[model samples]
Target: MTDIQFDDRVAIVTGAGSGLGRGYALELARRGAKVVVNDLGGSPSGVGASASAAQRVVQEITDAGGEAVASTDSVATRAGGAAIVQTALDTWGKVDVLISNAGFLRNNRFEDLTDEEIDPIVDVHLKGAFYVGQPAYRAMRAGGYGRILFTGSSSGAFGHAWQANYAASKAGMIGLSNAVAIEGSAYGIQSNVLLPNALSRLEEVMTPGYMEIPAFAEALQSTDFSFADGRMTPEFTVPLAVYLVSEACTATQGIYSSNSGRYSRVRLAEAEGWVSPAGTTPPAVEDIGANFEEISELRDFSLPAHNYDEFTIAAKVARARGIHS
Candidate 1:
């Protein structure tokens, strides 16, 4: 396939002050998308805001001969999110792509984590995506075309130590992306989540012993080791993201993991478990316990579109046995 380009599209990239968001903003701008570079300029812990980080990225984009505008808006608030989207509209006249990449991290053991720690993480990572996306989604619905790329994380989809709050926030993004994909389909808007493993501010908090794992180390090292002095850089993952949030991409409701020149899709599905006869009284706990292996078998599974689809499958099984009651 030819390289994807966004010739006349307008794009919004949050958290673009640094790290992965910066790379995405620059790449999209380079591809001819008029970009709204939205960043709160907050620290990795999500404290203290500055405008320079965002403006610096905008400067880099324009200096590289790409079109972009700076937005120092906090995505954690509804008003801030609206301002971020407004920047794109006021400057470019339309919004075609939204990369919900703004996020912050707080690391603590599950038990040690507090509501205070959890709320801000949720605000920046999960709720922030919703705040920014809701307005952008409506605009896209009106325009009849759009693309949304959500920044999920391996910490949530896979697992990570000392990241209970962060994981919950990241995991919530998957649900958000899934719903957006379904709702935006008729409007020509596609939404997908990315579990990106790249070098960024969050990496500093990662336990060093964890990186000793072979898979972890390999995943951390980009093909060009020089990018991060023998580690991965944010740029390695941004290309795939740009394509996923481009008009050229038709994929939606997908979870993708990208790093070190690798890209793969992640699907959430359920097995077709053993079912009890519908007319029969509710099966005893012993019956369910006895059939645990069959129930948990992964040989055949259905990728349900929603909770109703799974129930629909159960309904089909009940009808098939002529046991509906």
Candidate 2:
């Protein structure tokens, strides 16, 4: 196997001050990619700010014989997003990679969630990706090559309680990533989403007493990268990320999850559903009721890679009805 390297690449890692983002920046730079580390240095709850977090990571990168620059601009605003990308351009002349990892946590029961929690979370996670993604896409398009990664959370897939705001925002990244992947395919720009589960300060917000919980405790038993039970670190997620955003990867529009020291692909599939026996008119209430099992069955499903693929079932229905050739 050829050793993967990024000797001539330039990468922008948002939220690089700490946690998974910090690990990503270090590894990418160690592999020869000149990195622009952007972080708001805000608290996990989305309040307060500092420059030390970002600058510290930059210092670590440089001290390790890697090239890196620090940017303390927020990813939650358009101006900040543009400025973040501009930082990379001004320093390196191009952006060959983007790890859209900037986000803060704000969660509560759906009914108890206030606009304060909802708006900022959405603005930083979903809108933040767009604010930077659009400009980064343009740079990638002009250069005709790029790799973009969106940091989505697995909580979005399996409805965790008290995570209404955070989960929704994370889910939005998948859609944005899919759209970028489709449009970028022709330009040699690949886009993918990551659902990372690593031990980080956000745990202070996500689950205050997680260690005391039996389920959370049992899952983190030093599988490989972990040193003990209930301690799965961010370094474990670095290699997977580095590969996905490298020249060797051809996958795009892909959703992946890394949890409990295991990595897997999560898919968005459409099930083959029961069709109404009668044509043109909608199915009767009783007819629909009779086929609930078939409608909900996942025995036969198709994974649509593009928007137009959704009509496949419709075409099949039309053919069965002899509606057209």
Candidate 3:
């Protein structure tokens, strides 16, 4: 087969100053994309800022003969997000791809996580995607084609201790991407989420003593033995992300996870539930308690594409029960 090239594509990768974002920006530029490298150069806890980080990545791309511009705008606010996209339009005339990859972590146990701690994560990870994604979606709708990717995390989907705030923010991103996928489907725009498990700066800058905690240590130890051998680098996760944001990708509304060379699609599935007879009174609590096994069984489940799909499934169940609207 032929290589997937991004020639003539204009991509906006937020948080492109380092780690996974940097890897993606460089790869896209190398493949002929005109990239906007947006990074606020903030610390892992989302405090402070600088422009040197974004400028350095732009320099790297330019040094390698690739086209790119640097934007030091934060992704935490609406104005910042629009400015990042506007930089792309100002420099390249249009945007074809968006990788919402800018994020930082403030890990703490649920009880200890205050508003000051939780708000920034939500602002950067969840709202940041919204701020950047909406304008990019509009541009893609007008341009007739686009690819969008949001950075999600296994912490939220599966659960991880001492990361309540971070996990909640990441989980919200999955919902945002799903909505974007459904709304943009008719306009040639595809949106998906990436749950990346890689060794990046986010981990390096974790709150002091977080890594030394026994639970965190045990969680790391339980992973496959091979994962310790330098296989979980950010570069390993870049190829899948690049593909998801490429024109060749037809997948939308997908949640994918990448870790130590393992790649798979993560889905939210609903089991076919037990339905009561239509001509009788509503089922009692005892009835539900008795049929709990059947109700919770996952043997036959359907993956609903959107909200309407859930309604369709409910309709099918109602029809089977001899009830019609």
Candidate 4:
């Protein structure tokens, strides 16, 4: 395989003060990309802010002979998001890459989640992407080149027992990424999502509860798993994050999951369901029950490329059922 480099590219990494975001910033800088390290410096539950978190990462990059600047702006507000993107444009004149990885956690059961908890998560993870993404997208369109990555989570894509708010927020990242990918296709821009499992302060807080389970505890201690440092440290995810937002990434709307040191693609496919026969009367509840097995089966499916794919697929199904020519 050939080496992947980001020479002369201007990249912005939000939440770069620590964890996976910091790892991405450092590696991108090392590979010749001028980085804008933006971090709100907030606590895990979205509580406070300080400049030190972002500034420290900036110092590390500069000390290593790399170019970077720190932005202590929040990704939760529209103005803050624009400011974060502006930090990059003001210094570099263009934005070639964006890693929208800034977010906070608020875990709770669905019934117990409050508006207060859910609102902040959505503001930072979902709206924040739009805030930063809008400006970066325009710059990319003008420059006619760009790569975008949204940090997603398994808690969102799958489900977690105590992370309803966080999960919902992360799931929105996938939808946002897909929309951007569709519109960006005409503008030399590509967008994708990353669901990474890395050890961070956020994980530190969540892991203890899972360790109480017997099977979970056993897996946690297993040596069969692979990781960048014998554990799910943030470094293991940096390379995959970097690639998704690099010139070398070929697919837009792609979703990748990084766990330990193993990487894999995550896709959303539409299952082909059973169609009522042409000229047949509407099925009653009992008729539907009789065909439930075929309806729920996953033997046939298609990965849609855009919103219109469903209509196209529907037309195909109708023709095959003799409903139309």
Q: What does candidate 2's lDDT look like per residue over 1-325, in tens digits? A: 9989999899999999999999999999999999999998899998988999999999999999999999999888999999999998999999999999988887676788899999999999999999988888899999999999999988887655677899999998889899999989999899999999888888778754434546645665533553435546898788888999999999899998877667899998887777765457888899888998988999977788787987876577557656634
Cα lDDT tens digits, model 1, 1-325, are: 7878889999999999999999999999888988999988888888899999999999999899989999998999999999999888888788999999998877776787898889999988888998999999988998999999999988899877678898889999999999999989989999999999887996665556545457756776644555345346887898889989987788999999986767899988888778886655889999999999989998977888877788897776567657654
RMSD of each: 3.9, 3.6, 2.4, 2.8
Task: State how far residue 316 of model 2 sits from its true place (Å).
Answer: 3.7
Q: Candidate 1 or 3, higher lDDT? A: 3
lDDT (Cα, tens digit) per residue for candidate 3, span 181-282: 888989999999999988888876565555667887787778666764787888899999999998888999999999888899999899888877665589
List, in order, the clash count of every candidate structure: 0, 0, 0, 0
For model 3, what is the error of residue 27's alpha carbon versus the real structure, in angstroms, after optimal superposition?
0.4
lDDT of each: 0.87, 0.88, 0.90, 0.87
Task: Give the true-structure RMSD of model 1.
Answer: 3.9
Clashing pairs in 2: none
Q: Which clashing pairs does model 4 show?
A: none
Greater-TM-score candidate between 1 and 3: 3
Candidate 1: list runs displaced more than 4 Å. 207-231, 315-325
